[model samples]
Target chain A: MKSKRILDALLAPMVAIIFSVVLASVILMLFGANPIETFSKMINYAATPRSISLILNSATTYYFSAVAVAIGFKMNLFNIGVNGQYRLATAVGALVAGALTFPGYISIPIVIFVSMLVGSLWAGIAAWLKVYRGVSEVISTIMLNFIAIGLIAYLLAPSMLGVQTAENVVGTPVIPESGRFPGFSIPGSQVPVYGMLFLAALLGFAYWFILNRTRFGFDLRSVGQSPSAAVASGVNVKRMTMYSMLLSGAVAGLVGLPLLLGAQYSFTVNFPGSYGFTGIAIALLGRNHPVGIAFGALLWAFLDVSSQILDLVGVPREIIVIMQGVIVLSVVIAYEITRRVKVRRQQDAVGKATAVAQ
Target chain B: MRRVIKIASVLFAGSLVLAACSSSDEAAVEENAAPVVKVGLAYDSGGRGDGTFNDAAAAGVDRAVAEFGVEVNEVEAADADGTPERAERLRLLASEGYNPVIAVGFAYSDALAEVAPEFPDTTFAIVDSVVDAPNVGSLIFAAEQGSFLVGTIAASASKSGKVGFIGGMEIDLIKAFQAGFEQGVKAVNPAATISVAYMGPAGDNSAWNAPDRAKTAVEGMIDKGVDIVYAAAGGSGLGMHQAIAAAGGSAKGYWGIGVDSDEYVLPARAEFKENIVTSMLKRVDTAVFDVIAGVVNGSPLTGIQNFDLSRGGVGYSSSNPVVSAFASVADGYAEKIKNGEITVSSTLTE
Candidate 1:
């Protein structure tokens, strides 16, 4: 029975993968490129050692974003403002880090903590709006993204960050070199130490533990599953909602640390990328499970990294976007199908047992 | 049912094998052809069809295809979310025989650094950022040089010596433009006050993409007794132009200066052709096309190429009717700057 359940658990993702490939192939056919060739090239490119490093690097941000989104999902909340949270956090982190003259050991952690605090504050505003003003978090967070962008731009502009020279255009003063995270080199390859991957994994495990083992986790989940029931059980639903959003923002803040401290070491206008929104897809694909999210992030990263070959094969890069959309759509459909199938099987067994008793 | 499943799995596996074999065969055919030059372009967050930077860069690719008759491929990143996606696209293009890939924004610097060394044979060109690699060409522009000219134009044309400069973001790059414009305005008309307001705060630089907000900001500037606003706000600058056009009062002759490509005659802003006082032309297309041409002609410059006013790579647009009216004044300033008579320093410290 356990083996069957394991098999069933695996089937949905497998079917989703198969359906995604088929859908991609159909689209490729319409574009007049041989789908087999294109897919093969993509697979081959993805399997390389350098590609593995790239995937790992990409997954770090993706995983964190997914965790942030998943935390909100657990509270029946949609944190659409992870993007805004990340932007605010990164700016705060970058500015604070840039201002400090501390050694690497003290500076990096302080920067990261400040970033998390700022990110939480930004997200907490949305939560406050949702709880007090009866505004939906989904709308509030989305609107906050625009406000964050505007504010950041205004602050970074010449009169504030002290535009030094032409060479440092579109960036804050470079974080002191001592404050940057050192890169670990992989032997026989140019890919640097993807230390952020391990950090993401640790955070994922922590998230999983907090969600499954702790009292706050239980309260949060209970509130999500049934707010009325949670209220009756003495859980503060509004407080839990606010806490979940704050936690979500904190997780999202970490998404920029790797880039700010490890690679770029300075804040650019669009430095964090779109990890916030992409994390939503990753969270859904993983079904809000930590381990599942890691796998989902890896798969998404692989597809993203591999699809670069589409251009070389005379296929429009937009097709990869279509494939991504199809994959997400198919996975959702497959998940629903498996769920319905399980419910139907249970009903059938119960009906048979009743008939026999009669 | 199990037998059917087995048969389907076998068919799928067969197709996979066939696909792999055919792709290899096609790759061999491509290899056998004339040294196929693969060029990869990592667009800005707006991606292609933005009718702005990405579109201008893609126009360079189109020119390469038409002029050199080389095989070309472009990757349009959906948004900033696709940084690694851009690098991956470069790697894929490299593996598939695309040489001399171009990443079109400063955003791709780190990604290029990570991906460039993996394929040493593949030459990379990144616009607006310096990546120190033997095979990489960093295309940077002296935006300040162009901004100086436009600032002079704005100052000379303004009736109210109080001109305005609305920027998309508050980065050093935009600051450089602002500084240069301020300097030029001071040089031409020292009494002219330049009120600067950026669209966003510190880090979130989405001001370049939001046209409505840009229009509002420009309108706000105009309301404060300022005319002839110079906008370096990317697509958002379009809003500034629109606002200027709407406030069609003769005494309040609000003019706008466009950035990057020449927007004075672009089809998108046909209505504001007359309202455009001047534009700071960064010439991204010229740089891109030149590099692609170099790749074709076997003379690609594999180091930093700084394009300034002297190179004709970055300058003010002389084609605009409004700008042409100030031909003698523009010429005088241009000659003075070129001949070391007027020095335009890029650093705030200077």
Candidate 2:
């Protein structure tokens, strides 16, 4: 039984990868580029030390984002608000870190914690709206993103942060030097800092523990599978739903820590990127499994890093975006196929057993 | 059992074939002739095709491709928060033989600092912010110099003694433009009152790109009896222009001043071209093209390249046919400003 389970686990990802490659090829051909060349360039570019570091850096944020989205997924809830939650958390954390001067060790943790709290709070607002007003999280979260932008903008302006120089640029004060993450050089290359990857791994393990080894996780999964069943089993479905979203937001908040506390140490207008949306792709790609998420994050990082190399090879960088969309679609289709196949086999086995018993 | 095993083996074999097929095709391409110069462009959040800043920078890249036949790769960082991702993207380009990577906007400054030294052989250029790296070239514009010229125009054209300055973000860079505009207005008409309102605060810079907020801010200024408004905001400037059009020939004839590359000529603002008193031309495209030109000619400029009004890098747009309507006033001030007769000071220290 154990061996069969292991085989199934390995086969799933392999199948997904194969499916993604085929889909990517069709996309490349549509764009009039050879699929083989594009995929090869992607792999070769990701093989380098610098490219590896870039991949790791990209993955750091994806881990948190994937886990956050996955939490909502487990509850059969779609938390499209990860983007807003993350933005709010990052803005608040950056403000807190930039405003107060603290020692490096203390400040970094405080900033990260504050970010998580702020993110949770932001998500909780939507959860509250959904629970009390019967408003859908999807709609509320989407609207909240615009509000988050406006609120953050107001706070970062001269009247609030007061960090602007004569240029009237809206950005927080630079975090004190002690508060910044130190970069460690790789043995032979000038590129430094691989610490964030370890941090991501640690977070991944934490996510796994919470999902599989804890009561809260069990309740979340039970509720996701069937709210009526969970209620009959004495689970507080509404509370669980709210908590799931809050927890998801908290996890998503961690996405900005590496960027904010790292070498830059300051929050700019473009600090959040599309990490919130990209996290959705990571969660979907990983099938909301923690281990799968880690791999998905790495794959995403690889694609992003490799796309730059594609530009060097005379290919448009936008092709990378097309490839990402293709990969996601292909993985989803492959998962559906696998699920159908498994169901059909199970039905066949059950019918044979019934005949033998009769 | 044998049937199941056979199916599994077939699936595995199919996967291997797929992977192999993709890898082999790439190998064939590399075996061919090497590509020429590889240039990577990292655009701002608005991305390329926004018909704005990113598009302007991409135009310079496209020009390089056409002129020198250099292989160009362009990526849109997509959002402000994606600087690290964008930086990582640039580093990837460097690793793959893209020698000179150009990151458009000051937002990439922090990322450039972390990534530039890692690839010392790879040269990086950042527009708007200065990075202190040997190989990194910081291309900055003297926006204040241009703002000063437009401020003069606004002061001269306004019937109301009250002028307004609408800024996108409250940054030191944009502040410089505001300060310069204020100074220029004061230089021409000492009694003119200049009210300054920024679209966003210090912590968030989206106000620079928010057209609605810009329009509201301009409308508010106009409501308070300010006739001529100078906009240092990017896309937000479009709002200011729109607000001017909306207030057409009202209590006080409203005039708008444009900024960043020449909004007076952009197709998006073509309708309001005549309403614009003048534009503070930042010339980012010209600077970008010049760098590409340098790279192709084997003499890529390094270190900081400052574009000031004195060098014609930053200044007011040429007397547009629309400006001809206000020609007498514009020509009068142009002569005075050019002949060392008027000094517009934007710096707080000055």
Candidate 3:
């Protein structure tokens, strides 16, 4: 039974992968593109030291985003507002960081703390609406996303949160060097891997430890599995929901920090947006497992970096997007089928055992 | 599950045969002797079909393909991707043996800086932003010069003695447009009240594409007695024109100035055809074509190539009949501008 479960676990993803490859190959052929050549070029480009570092940096951001969504998922909550939470947090965080002149340790933590506080504050609103106002979190969070964007749009104007940079590109004033994260070179490449990669790792470890080993985590999961039962069993369901939602939002707030402090140093108009939606997909693919999420983020990042080479090879880079979508869809279907098969097999074994005893 | 796999494999086998059949067309292209020069165009977030800046770049490449027979590959930046993606696109172009890789946006400045050093032999041309690299060609336009001409038209055409300048973002590039427009309006009618407002801040590129916001800004200006509105806000200009058309329109003497390409005859802006007085012609197409020509002719264009009015790189579109009334006044300014007699400031004073 144990071996069968293990086989099911490995087989589902493998089948999905193979199916997606075949489907993608057929689509490429229909488009008159040589999929073999196109894929080989992508693999070759991604194999480079510089490209590997790029992938890792992208994966780090994706990993954090996935973990943030995973926290909400564990509670059966869909916090779509991660998009707005992170943007608002980063904007406020950048402003706070820019005003301070503290040392690296003091300022970085303050910036990160402010970011988490703001993110939690925003997410807390959705939780409050859900618990008290009886508003669906999905709707409230999505609406909040737009509200967040609107708020930033209003605030980031020159008279508000912005200062004009060179060539009319207005952004937040650069943070002091003391507050900025120091990036280090990846072995042989000039490209500096984001120092906050360590932060992502640390967060991933925390996510695993807290969710698996803590009492609060138990209440959160109990409510998620069965809210009515948990309520009868003395779990504060509403409080658990609020806690998990706030925790998710706090993590969501850190999504942009690595890029903000490490590369941009200020929140420019182009402070990377839309990681929240991508996070949903990564979380779904990872099935809320920390290690699974890390792999999922890497795979997503790999596809993004690799597909860039498709444009060079005279193939549409959008093929990669299609492939990614197919992989996600097929994997989901494959997992569902495997789960049903495992359940059926377990019932069959029990039936046979009962018949033999009779 | 077995049956599903069997059907999928069979379908896959059928597609393989069909795919093999389709490969013949591409095979024929591969058989051709390699072209002398290969140009790769890396478009900004708004790639082709934008009917504006990117379309203008595409037009230049199309012309190059027809006239010079140079092979061209075009890549667009995804909306959600950032600087690293831009750099990766450029690197991909360079690695694939594309020469004179032209980046269509100012956002490519950082990307070009990173990629240019790694591939020193490759020639990179970036529109809008200047990078100090030996191999980089900065194809910057004197949009202020063009904006000045449109501003002159707005001053002449306005009945309310007030005009409006709706910029996409409060960035320096867009400010250049505002400065020129404001100066031109002031130059013609010193007492004219020119109300200026930006659609949004610099961080969001959607500011340039947001029609609703542009329309709202235009409506606000019109309410305040501004009869003439000039939109230098990329795709957002369409909304401004639409707003002007909704408010009594061109036949009723309300006017809008278009930007980038001549929008007077563009099918997309056909409904607001009469309302468009004249477009500020920032000839990105001419500049792109010229650069490709230079490359093919062995000059291999490098450094800053400023497109000003004297070289026909920037000017007022003469497509509209209403513009004929101000032709003489506009001509005087154009001649003076070309002759270096009247120096137009690109900076916003005040």
Which model scores highest in TM-score?
A: 3
Q: How much of the true A–B contact set does each candidate keep?
A: 0.30, 0.27, 0.26
Q: Estimate each model's TM-score.
A: 0.79, 0.77, 0.84
RMSD of each: 7.9, 8.0, 6.4
> Could you give candidate 2's per-residue lDDT for residues A1-358 as a string of tens digits?
9999767766756776676677667766876888787778778767777666667777877888888888887887777778778877887887788766778788778888899999999999989998889998878987887788778767776557736421223467877777776666656544555456677788888888988999988988898888899999999998998899889889878877776676446666656645777777778778788888988998887877776667556455555565566566556656667778989999999999999999
- For every prediction, compared with the true complex, DockQ reads 0.21, 0.20, 0.23
**Full ranking by lDDT:** 3, 1, 2
Off by over 4 Å in 3: A10-12, A95-107, A150-165, A175-188, A333-358, B1-34, B64-68, B155-166, B182-200, B211-229, B240-256, B265-276, B293-305, B336-350
Residues B195-277 of candidate 2: C-alpha lDDT, one tens digit per residue: 88888754354675778988888888888899988887766777888888999822347778777756667776788877776
Model 1: per-residue Cα lDDT over A19-78, one tens digit each: 888987897898788989888888887777777777787788789998998898888888
Scored by DockQ, the top model is: 3
Clashes of 1: 20
Scored by TM against the true chain B, the candidates give 0.85, 0.81, 0.88
User: For model 1, how big is the CA root-mean-square deviation?
Assistant: 7.9
What is the C-alpha local distance difference test score of candidate 3? 0.81
lDDT of each: 0.75, 0.72, 0.81
Better of 1 and 2 by lDDT: 1
| Candidate 1 chain B worst ten-residue window by lDDT | B23-32
